[model samples]
Target: MSVSSAIPTAILTGFLGAGKTSLLNSLLKDPMLANACVVINEFGEVGIDHLLVEKSDENIIELANGCLCCTIRGDLINTLTDLLARRDAGSIKAFDRVVIETTGLADPAPVLHALVRDEFLLNRLRLEGVITVVDAVNGWATLDAHPEAIKQVAVADRIVLTKLDLLHGVEGEDKMFAIIGRLRKLNPTARLLATHRGEATAERLFNMGLFDAAKKTPQVQAWLNDEALSKVHRHHHDVSRHDAHIRSFSLRDERAISPEGLEVFFAMLAAHHGENLLRMKGVIKLADEPDKPLAVHAVQHVFHPPLRLASWPDGKAETRLVFIVRDIPKQVIEELFSAFTDQLQGDAMTDKTLSLSRT
Candidate 1:
């Protein structure tokens, strides 16, 4: 389904004690997000975030601002499907958007995979983007110690830096700057927003998907963020060796690729190196229809059905892919892509030559 046709769903995640609840509370109260339905996922048996709202027996809470909140009972798919059913039946307030708050220790890839790959969810919901909350005071230490914390930052579209208000004096300022530098290294494409003095607001966080909410048009450049990725790649050595395990990079090709070649490339990547791939998103210029670029997305091994745009957003007909991965070398992916696409081009030329000889 095209992104514009589905509900824009945002995933809110953070490390332990990163103040995700504070951000969620603030976001839910925003007038722009008044029609949003939130699904809160907690690690343990008892979920705490939803308790802040007025409770109901069915684990669903109705906020005074016309927002709805529900805790995941067993399966996330079940929870979302139920919400859709309720809205359609007029049993619940219809929500135009969804904000899913994941547990502190959760890996967000699975949640994204479900949203993109699920047959039912794909038609009803579109992945808006990931909003990761980072605690500025302890963020550097947390990232160093926990891989989950690092992954959260790596896959974020927007990184919210919390606890800046608590920082004081020159030492605190230095520490804050250092953390921001590290965040840029981990994920340069994500927009870093400080929550100090109420800077991080709903206006800055949502509707960052394939289509811009305000314009109702494709925002390919913003969604791809290739410019930021390219800048990071230029200063690749500036990133610490300790951070070598996780890296973000972009690949571009001016040549159009056949449908078969594209299939083989993705299949091999997923089957062999899926675990290392954190997230992949790109716009492809297909050989069959070069003008109608195809937007592709994948989380780990699962991929979203490619959506064809009406036209290239920037009027530049080229293929560009951005990847956030763990322990997957850029050279490896580049070689694999080249082998399939180039070989297919050669075969096509040879067939054309054979047809000319017969004529």
Candidate 2:
């Protein structure tokens, strides 16, 4: 049921005053994103940032709810479905990709879950990556006060530092670099970039290794580095106190998972901890498809459709998953994965027994 031409979607998130709208505007100006579709979510009152985007046609839809992750599940799905229909009908110029601009205070996990867990849309889309914006001037304080901000950074594939223009001559550059260092400590897999008033180039932002559908050496190296950082930060207590409620962890094993088992695992996870599961992304070796590793990426419970790569990147034939969760312990997730794997093995054994008895 997988479609070959499904477009990639990227989620853009940040804390309050991170300049996401400004960045979106800059990205729209690029010819590469000329055919890209955008979904912008606002907190309290819907503002005029939608009007500011000049290059793209007016297809802006606002999520009036506090955050798309919490309140706009139905609306989000229906809207995306409708957009796809229109693209199919050729009503709008065919868009190459979609970008979701989350509210300043939004938690990106649920939004990702919606993309991945939906049965109808699972085969129609792919999650490119998460791009989080951090305000250079107020990021440290925001991370300290708001647990959401920490979760945003923990799950980001790319972190953009904004408002450097305002930091001129105010001892801001040092503080910004310090924040970037902290971010690297939090999630070393994420690449950091600086932008002035969201004036970053689109080439530097989109198509970030998510759509290759093949094993790439750079991506494998990045994943390995991310694994190393996660191990190092697990013992670092100073960083833990800054956002005590949020944490990031990785799960890996040499065994391949059955598709049914994987589905059951994700369904149970979404049902039990959808609110706390901020982001999850990984490469898995499925039992039926050992030669082709499946890439799974999700925010909250929403997941983009699983993609099959041409070959294993770096020849690592293991399953590795990274999670950014809020108030969810690493041990809890580890135990959950263990229990699921055990159950899957038991089920297979019982099926084998039944077949032997029938014979």
Candidate 3:
């Protein structure tokens, strides 16, 4: 693949004062991200981070229009379109990947929706993953008080616990771990990493194949072995009447899904539950193409066009989808899938019989 095709876009999101800019600076210093194009959104009038980022020239675009969550969708689309046009025209060195650093107080759902819903953009761009930075010191309090913080964590494919160095050998260490444990419950599918001075490896932060990004391995039957999910599930079960605001669930079935049917189902789901659906990632077995599996990943409502892997990593044929949702019943999603499979089964049978008779 070419450089443009090789690169993957990532969204950096977190609540106010969660160290998003610091993380961005760290990423920019890394040689791995040298070919990155950054989009920065400032919540206030003065944009200081643009000055902080050591860009070569004109690669970093700042959207001073408004907060990304509310009023900058047009600017974002236009900026991205222009960026792509310049890249294709060979005006600038072809960028490997694009990174959008959202405002600290921004809600990422709307931003994601705009990226995935646009017809022209969706074909060219792919949502690699969402990286949410959580302040190790104030994370618990922030999640408890701010709905935006909850949404940030909920939609993340990878969660980075920042400011760990500040808590060294102090009482805050235990508190930070406990907070991370709680966040694990909120988003078990997302890999959790501890970052010092906002520094981390690209391999640890990205390429999460909806399974184990850190391990670079597929989790099929091992999904049940994820300690984060089990620990959180137990905690929720222990406190049944507590704040049931956010719930995480994993659904796996042996049936293979058709690519067309999967597309329609995802489009419908995104339209209906754009706000409620936080993060979704899954590895699917397609009925028509059993030799290759489809990998589906989405942050909020934006989905990367399904990627077809050469072969299943571990020879497992099951389709597994993990969802981190807010106030959305697990049964609703389950029923939707059940209905889709039933309808598709009928069509599959007809196609199979027709093919057999022709042969």
Q: Please estimate how well model 2 matches the true structure, expressed as its whole-model Cα lDDT.
A: 0.68
Winning candidate number (lDDT): 1
Candidates in order: C-alpha RMSD to true structure: 5.5, 7.0, 7.4
lDDT of candidate model 3 versus the reference = 0.66
How much is the lDDT of residue 4 in candidate 1?
65
Determine the backbone clash count of candidate 2.
Answer: 14
* Candidate 1 lDDT over residue span 25-107, tens digit each: 78877899888888987424223355345646476778777888888878899889999999999999989999998888988
- Backbone clash pairs for candidate 3 read none
Which ranges in model 1 have alpha carbons more than 4 Å from their true place? 43-55, 211-218, 233-242, 345-359
The lDDT of each candidate is 0.81, 0.68, 0.66
Candidate 1: lDDT of 262? 86
- Ranking of all candidate structures by their lDDT, best first: 1, 2, 3
Task: Specify the poorest-scoring 10-residue window by lDDT in model 3.
Answer: 62-71
Q: Write the per-residue lDDT of candidate 3 for residues 230-323, one digit (tens) a residue.
A: 5554454334422357888877777876777677668767777756677777777787888777777675667756666666657777777778
